[model samples]
Target: MTFEQHISGNIEYLERPGSIGGPVLVMLHGIGSNAASFTPLLDHLPRDWRVIAWNAPGYGGSIPLDAEWPLALDYAAALKDFLDRLELKRVLLAGHSLGCLIGAAYAAAHRERVVRLLLSSPALGHGVPCGGALSAAAQARIDDLQTLGPDGFAALRAPRLVFEPESNPEIVRYVRDGMARVSLPGYPKAARMLASGRLIDDAERLQVPTDVIVGAHDVVTPPDSARRAHAALRHPWRGAFTLVPGAGHALYQQAPVAFAAALAALAETVG
Candidate 1:
């Protein structure tokens, strides 16, 4: 399933169209990731299920947001604009790591726009209030980017995204390639959003059906964090927290079969 790249207004996304009137799935990648990062999961997904993965503002060719320190709501608004331009009335929203924050905001605020929500290795942001200084962790992301540059930053951090880098060289390289594309303004803005995001709060407010999954071996957003987020969901899809085995932070890439099966199960059984 080859994904075709398209630009709708200021947003850039990769799409793999399915049968007419089929279910639509919108994928949002993490801070270090781009739409291309979802490629590994595509082959495992059903060809008839339309999948669209966006390169959040600043990544890929998309323009950066105006606010230097944007919030999850700002990203949600961008997402709304992108969906509006596509004339999509509703969709299945899937978020990974940092993307969970943005997706949670959107799904909570625009409940009518999302039919279901799927989260992977959900990142619990720093939850700093607006106008507050960036947390040490958030600041480190920016500092590392400045100190290492894109390629170096990717090389240094990409392996950490996987459980065992030595065993998963291909996945490591893929993540590295994606992270190496991160540029200024966008990366910093996203960093600030991470500092401000409170994914659990948004999850608690969601009226839409939601499911959360994490890699059993994930160190970034470990199973415990994912469980906490799942506990916060008001309408968990199956009232369960899924942990994909033999996977890590990059579970979608590391355990594509399990990831795809979980996604398909959600679509098939969850209405």
Candidate 2:
């Protein structure tokens, strides 16, 4: 595995190179997590499949957006540039939580580059009650983070990310550590994007194969949310809403085996 700066030195990504001619999987971590969050998932995937997990702008050592509070499209533009720099013409894009929103935006604008998309524990922005409600909710998260700080905020919310946090000490640590790594300067902007993102609209515009997978027990973005997002897809029949039993919002971490299996299934269907 290697971490290198790409896209004219604006983006930093963790990569696991595969054999020549093997398919590529570009993984995007959620708001509070970095590319390392997909470490376990990478371990479970086929060794021959190349994997690239990006530390989205504002997280880890990656650069932050120039805007005070950028929109989802802003993030999408960065992702597109990253892909272009890597010379990846087509790829299997998998995103988690906030990454889902950004991925949807990219797929909508650059349909030809994305052959397949997998949204794991997606955070459906517009799927919330109303625009006002979403904004208010997003503001609340920003407020909490600003007040509590990263360590405090992680302490308060990390446990809620997984089911039976008491029984899963390792996962709890993983969640907390990932959240603690979030950049204070970048998080507020990401929260604003999350609250006001047009993920549903973007999903509806997607022309390639898509899948929404959520942990049945996920409270942050529940099964109902995933179903709604799946229903909004332009090709609902071609897409699917899969529920990983007994898992929670941290589905990828809690059930890496099952989550990887789901991803492999999608890859098999890709042309």
Candidate 3:
């Protein structure tokens, strides 16, 4: 499959075109990742599926939001506009970490556009009491980036994101490279958005099918957190919660086959 850049309106994305009648899968990357982060995972998906992975606002040369610190809804609005520009009326939406926050918000706002929602290494941002801790952590991330700079921040943060960085040099390099591409001004704003996210509330309000997948060893948004997010799901729209073995926060990179398997299952079952 070939991946290339496409710009419609003001948004830029990396897209792998699919055969006619195939399902459309739109991927949203995590905070420290770009559209390229989904390459390995995309390789494991069905060849016929149309896959489009977006470099979220400010990442990978994409446009940044005008606001100093935009909310999750702001990011979701940009996503909606991107879809509209492309004329993608319906798609299977998947997201990782911070992307999950945006995906959930988008699904809540535009229920008809998303057929199914898949959240990988899901990061649920509850507001207020729990939000306080998340906000502080997000600020710390911004502070660390400011102090360390891109390369330095990637060096220190990349290894910890995976389960076994010392033994997995290749994955370490990949993660580090992705992190190094993070947009400084954009990242701080994203962190602030994450700090104020309301994913659980959105999940409760969702009317379409949704699934949550997480790596068993993920320290950042561990299995417990994924479970809690699933538990918070309200009646009719609630879906499955899966834990993939031998992976961590960067599960899509470390165990892409299993990650894709979970995603494929969701696609087949939901379709």
Using TM-score as the measure, the top candidate is: 1
Tens digits of per-residue lDDT, candidate 2, 1-271, equal: 3444443468888888888988898988888788888888877888888889898988877889988767888999999988888889999899899999999888888888887899888888744333344476787888889899889989888999999999998999999999988767889878878877767788788887898899989999888988878888875425767889889998899999989987886677556
Candidate 1: residue pairs that collide: none
Determine the C-alpha RMSD for candidate 1 after optimal superposition of all C-alphas. Answer: 1.3
Q: Which model, 1 or 3, shows the larger lDDT?
A: 1
Tens-digit per-residue lDDT, 153-208, candidate 3: 89999988898788888998999999998866889878878878777788788877
* C-alpha RMSD values across all candidates: 1.3, 2.4, 2.1
List, residue by residue over 42-125, the lDDT tens digit for candidate 1: 888888899999999988889999998999999999999999999999898889999999999998899888888888899989
Q: How many residue pairs in model 2 have overlapping backbones? A: 0
Weakest ten-residue segment in model 3 by summed lDDT: 126-135
TM-score of 1: 0.97
Per-residue error (Å), model 3, residue 74: 0.8
